[model samples]
Target: MDELKVKKSPLERAKMTLSVLALIIIAACSKVEGQADLQKRQGEETPIQVVSTIGMITDVVREVGGDEVDVNGLMGPGVDPHLYKASQGDVGKLDKADIIFYGGLHLEGKMTEIFKKLERQKRTIAVSKNINPKLLRSGKDAGGSEYDPHIWFNVKHWVSATETIRDTLSEYDPEHAEKYRQNADHYIRQLNELNAEVKERIKEIPESGRVLVTAHDAFGYFGDAYGIKVMGLQGISTASEYGSKDVSKLRDYLVENKIKAVFVESSIPTKSMEAVIAGAAEKGHTVKIGGELYSDSLGEPGSDADTYVKMVRHNVNTIVEALK
Candidate 1:
């Protein structure tokens, strides 16, 4: 017996064609992805992936590693490293990073535990490790850190940090060791120039007018390096609260010293400094808010204070102009 022939509808024919095209596209994509993966595994010369907790560390890594590193800073402009916590997305980034760098010395107070755990699995370095503990300032509060973590404020110390970055990168990527050393040497020279400029600019301020008061004590290193007296409404960490007594004491000190201005940090709340100002005003002293200073973080992209050197220059200029 002969079977009857069946005619397919136009819609059915089109659907079948579309299904075949989809399968073909999927197969092609899979093949491409597999090939890419194979290439990656075949000793491809990709940039060394790095994740730095703060922009200053990121800037140094980029300057030293140059084209050899692909770096991402976890914290950006105006971020308070003392209180910044890593999100799930940040953890993902950390997982993929070949190396991680942080300010350390409890500067990254919240992420300290996370970094400690990450250190076991990957190369995690604290740039501040190279700093001499003797050079670090002692914390003022009863229950504060023994050593201050704001070493970057001292340009000379940061130059040492650049050496640590160079050695770490060279050890991890020996293939380009000479390149890393050369880059670091160049960057160190730039930092030296920055230090000289800072000293010269600071000289513009009168001896008695060199007091730098801010919302927090982030500039202890700055004060020590540049011969300025630094005061803050809060302690070494922003986590420290100020009592009315603390405010009154600072108010009396500012009035006695005839301080012209008090500065607010970019990452810290203005209320603390405002309270200090009010207290000083009540004591019959006129204190102005000096321009905002980039403390824990750098300024936004395209701003004059975006880079480390620029940030320092901007701060010095602001301090000198306000006080002079």
Candidate 2:
């Protein structure tokens, strides 16, 4: 006897088709989720691009932003920000940056127009702009703005600038705001300690020998905060011309006061200070060239004054060792 063959019911076939469709939908959803996860990972891996005008600002951003930012400084070691002009390469860097930080009050006088133009297109900031006006020293640069931009010399003022950088970074990347705050707090504490250290070190110099004579007036804030008298051959900006009369005046002051050492600036030519030393020698006063101080720029990489903190410590050490 032969067995009878039977066809499957339509409902049973429909049920099998729906089961296959459901599997495809689930697989598709999983693929989409994997792609989303990859994108999120990629976003987290990318750092915020930053362009800073000077080394001090660059160091602060690095300290505060930590691993979250990639900073490129336009003016490197031994570069004068007051006279620094933006190159084509620098413009490209600025254009590509997510944020730009500069020392305001005409620190980068030649590049002011570039920063102004960039402000319209990006988050351009002047780190010194937010500092208390009362803390600022009046500028004597006839061709420059009305205030000195060397706020970093005073560690306390720099603490304010650090806070500004932290706030700006936090505003831009809210996910890393807490990280920035923590980093800033740590940095500020270090600065406070540094401030105290500087005060104590400065006191080691005899009260009469506490005068700091440098190539220019860049150390005004430093002298003010540390209770040292400051004199310079030229005005606040290196752009100011120091003529024979100015040199004579400084030379006479050194000879009259029996000052032993005057510092040459890293960013400035040593010829002017050398001239003053020579003039003093001619008048029977022995004056020596003190160690070079990092002014308007940081020291080269691997040098003692390369970073901001190191720069401050190096300057104080050099000054005290020479004058005390």
lDDT for each residue of candidate 1 in 240-309, tens digit (9 for 90 to 100): 8789998998899999988979999999989988998898899899998998999999999999988898
- Using TM-score as the measure, which candidate wins? 1
Q: Specify the poorest-scoring 10-residue window by lDDT in model 1.
A: 138-147
TM agreement with the true structure for every prediction: 0.87, 0.86
lDDT of 1 at 67: 96
Give lDDT tens digits, candidate 2, residues 265-297. 999999999999999999999999889999888
Model 2: which ten-residue window has the lowest total lDDT? 140-149
lDDT of 2 at 252: 96
Question: What residue runs in model 1 are displaced by over 4 Å at the alpha carbon?
Answer: 1-39, 140-143
lDDT of 2 at 90: 93
The alpha-carbon lDDT assigned to residue 257 of candidate 2 equals 93
lDDT leader: 2
lDDT of 2: 0.92
